[model samples]
Target: MRKIIFLGALIGLIAFSCARLDSFLFNPYKTDEYKLDAYDGKLQFRLGPEFDIPQDKIHLFSISSQGYKIWGIYIGDTTTISSDTVILYCHGNTGHIDYYWQRAKLLAHVGGKLRYGVLIFDYRGYGKSEGEPSEEAIYEDTKAMMQWLKDKGLTGDRLVIYGYSMGTAPATYWSSHDGPLTPRWLILEAPFASAELMVQDGAYFVLPKQYVTDLEINNAEWIKNAKAPLLLFHGTEDKLLALDPHGKTVFDNHPGPKQAVFVEGATHSDVPVILGIEAYISEIYNFIKSH
Candidate 1:
């Protein structure tokens, strides 16, 4: 039985939180949306050690929600921390750090002209991270990592939060709710409307909206409060979540400075390719610089 994180009942149907319905209606893999632990489970971060390991793997473990350990890797050369901008990437559901390493390398170069470092982690229950996965738990994992960055002298407008697919939830949640810890920019690639809406096409609408376990992302409710510039990108040919109510909907909901980029023939995860990597990076670079 899945633990209920919120309400006991909703609209008089069977009461279930989104966390409970998560596995039932979404792809458990990608929906993991969240891993991070160092080479070992130790909490310390070390510089390039003489030991043989994967390239650019700066493994660090942070105390996550309820004290779980989050397994993450900082991809970039040693000069990354000294760079003015660091992108804290919240990846989509599924897989672990190894699965995202290639892309992490690419994203780490997004603001190369300005020298940006990219940090991506796996949520608990995914890869090397500890504990189970849940709504609030994932946010706590992000907070733990964000705090880790803060403690290392990274703060203020120097940070950029990037969310892909299901990751938009944590990115937006933390950006809007983190107070002074807020990022200078928030970017969402292929964001969905909400948990209930996300499960609709895949779950075939079998569950009533009212009773769909409330793994609610509810980005619409939070984007309005974001203090940083928001960038939303979605494919016109998205085959999973629709573009209208999901991407466009959230883009419309944002109340702060923002830009919406629609790639003509792009599909989910291929926006960078479709838009031309140089062009895409330029847009992001200009956005962050202007703000």
Candidate 2:
């Protein structure tokens, strides 16, 4: 009887831990308007006036993702939506588009000032987007965005998929798999390799990823089949994802035309700022120009 009781208690403990792990992976805050100052306490520097985007150029809209309405922002001339090369940016798992608005603005200057259209959106269960969040939901949400782009006359050859941190999972997955559209280039910054690696990193043991979370995010493996030329950036001092286990692992596993830059002192959140905006833009511009 004691053995039976102990076994049941152990199972209960494992189940509870798994649920907690899953919840801890995603951190989102609700917002009706973009409060840039909300993240001020955590970030060392706020986006300056130089990064201000023109109100006329800023387009906000929503699309249906798995029957849930998700919001997206496009920074460019709508008149050129069909002809311009667009960068579909997948932001990190955190707050809504407001938290990443600055990053999207930076991408608008990638090739040149407003040379390319930049698109970013909030996934379901985040910000104003409705419904719950999950691994499959994110993938479908991202796919829905691609479909919207396709309907706008943007072809796979003119699309660039850029993913940072938690965003890398869907970016890598869609880039490799047969999806709504294929990207001409793949860019990853501060990418986590897989849920298994995440589990290994946090638990300090070789535990199965399923034991903690049902998330099957695996950029390291999915990247192997990606045909688009890859440009990857990893901060050497990234404490959140780390260099060796996460970013480097994904870079090493990729089997295609690839370029990697391990920024000297950049952290998980500030790769572009630490790498220098000019240099960051140059790297992406050159990559797109060459490929």
Candidate 3:
């Protein structure tokens, strides 16, 4: 009986220690500086392939925000027509903008087919952008990007926001808020319900969600209030995101024109390919046309 009691106490202590460490890692304040440093190196090494399009065709610029600088790649008709619509892409969490070059190429190709501009950027700390990545910082960065685009004359009525994976937070938050610049359409790929729930499900594996701090970007709450047209894409066999409940939760709660496509036999990273790139583009084009 004494041995059993001692073993129980030991187990409790171990669990407590783990929980404490998880909380530390999740704490935005504690992780910010370190993450910022890491982002700098990542950005440097991940520069996108150099394409020599006419200066008028592509514009590369950086926007300054509190504690960060966001880098962007703008591709569109230089003619600057007043009624031109554009797609602003918020890429998934990963290395940098260069990693998304292929996707950008695809967007430009499809944008040409659909006759819309496509602008994609690296979040602060992810690509050539400066600063560390945090939930709040990403939200602010996205707002800055939108403002920069709007200042160039793109308005909400002519804008579509695409959020992939972790990018969903800021995209959803902006859409939900009562603001002057709401996107005409919002697209989420493999979106999780909430940061808290995402962590709770052991998605990261390395660290539990409970350990993270500043779980401010709750999509489930935000999606309930969003008014823009929404489209969700998730893989049926997504092991990384646990597709069913999270994706379903968002789809059900969203109060707007919405569609969800489940790619059969698709894992987290392969949904776009499995769905067929051409078909995917067509679906998006059709959705935009109908809405």
Candidate 4:
């Protein structure tokens, strides 16, 4: 009995140590100097004259959030309508919204052609936003920005949310719980199954598929409660996020009018273009129009 007890204690200690290491590696509260550097890189990318969209076509705005200022661009033929359908774009992890200048142009063209407005903002710790990046902080920032839009009189059906990569977390979280001001549509590109699964997959080649944690941002759960139409885009060849299963998982679980586009030969970063940008924009335009 003493030997069994000893073995039991040893197993408990091992489990505790593993848990500590996991917390250290995947601590949501942890911020690094590298994140600051990434923020600076975003600023350099955004402020240069090349990053500026044609001022004649797009209106630029800045809003204050806790310890940060979010800079965003609004694009449309503002003269057309006082209240237009607005797309709030939450971009991926790597770079700022400025990095998507071309994509913005395409989206703006679609918005102009389709008679909607487009707004894309950089998260705090990115571009002109003035703080560190954290899961909760980004969610608050998105909420603040959304409120700013609503304060300007945009309503649920007129507001669409688009998220790419890490952006999907905040978008999903906000869409799931942000009381009366729900978005009309939710678009997720290359979304992960959950944060915990992402970390597990990063640590081990394959996530075990059963472990549960509070830290997980289960888009699956959020989607079930989401009232908005959801459109997902994934690349069949995306190795980083594993398109087929993860994207399919979210699509299957989402309980709303939904569509998924799998780009044939594209990777995670290029699916937007490879799927035919025109068609992608048209899909969004059509979705907005139909709803």
lDDT of 1 at 48: 30
Model 2 TM-score on a 0 to 1 scale? 0.91
Best by TM-score: 2
Candidate 4 Cα misplacement greater than 4 A, ranges: 1-54, 77-82, 111-114, 202-215
* Pick by lDDT: 2 or 3, better one: 2
Tens-place lDDT per residue, model 2, 102-173, is 788788888777889999988878877888777787788889999999889899999999998989988999
Which pairs of residues have clashing backbones in candidate 2? none
What TM-score do all the candidates reach, one by one?
0.77, 0.91, 0.78, 0.76
Ranking by lDDT: 2, 3, 1, 4
Name the TM-score of candidate 4. 0.76
What CA RMSD would candidate 3 show?
A: 6.9
Q: Ten residues in a row with the worst lDDT in model 3? A: 28-37
Segments in model 2 whose C-alpha atoms lie over 4 Å from true places:
1-20, 35-44
lDDT of 1 at 4: 50
1 or 4, greater by lDDT: 1
List the candidate 3 regions with Cα displacement exceeding 4 Å. Answer: 1-56, 78-82, 111-114, 203-212
Q: Which window of 10 residues has the lowest lDDT sum in candidate 2?
A: 36-45
Give lDDT tens digits, candidate 4, residues 180-209.
369988888888877656667666756553
Instruction: For candidate 4, give the lDDT of residue 254.
Output: 88
User: Which model, 1 or 4, shows the larger TM-score?
Assistant: 1
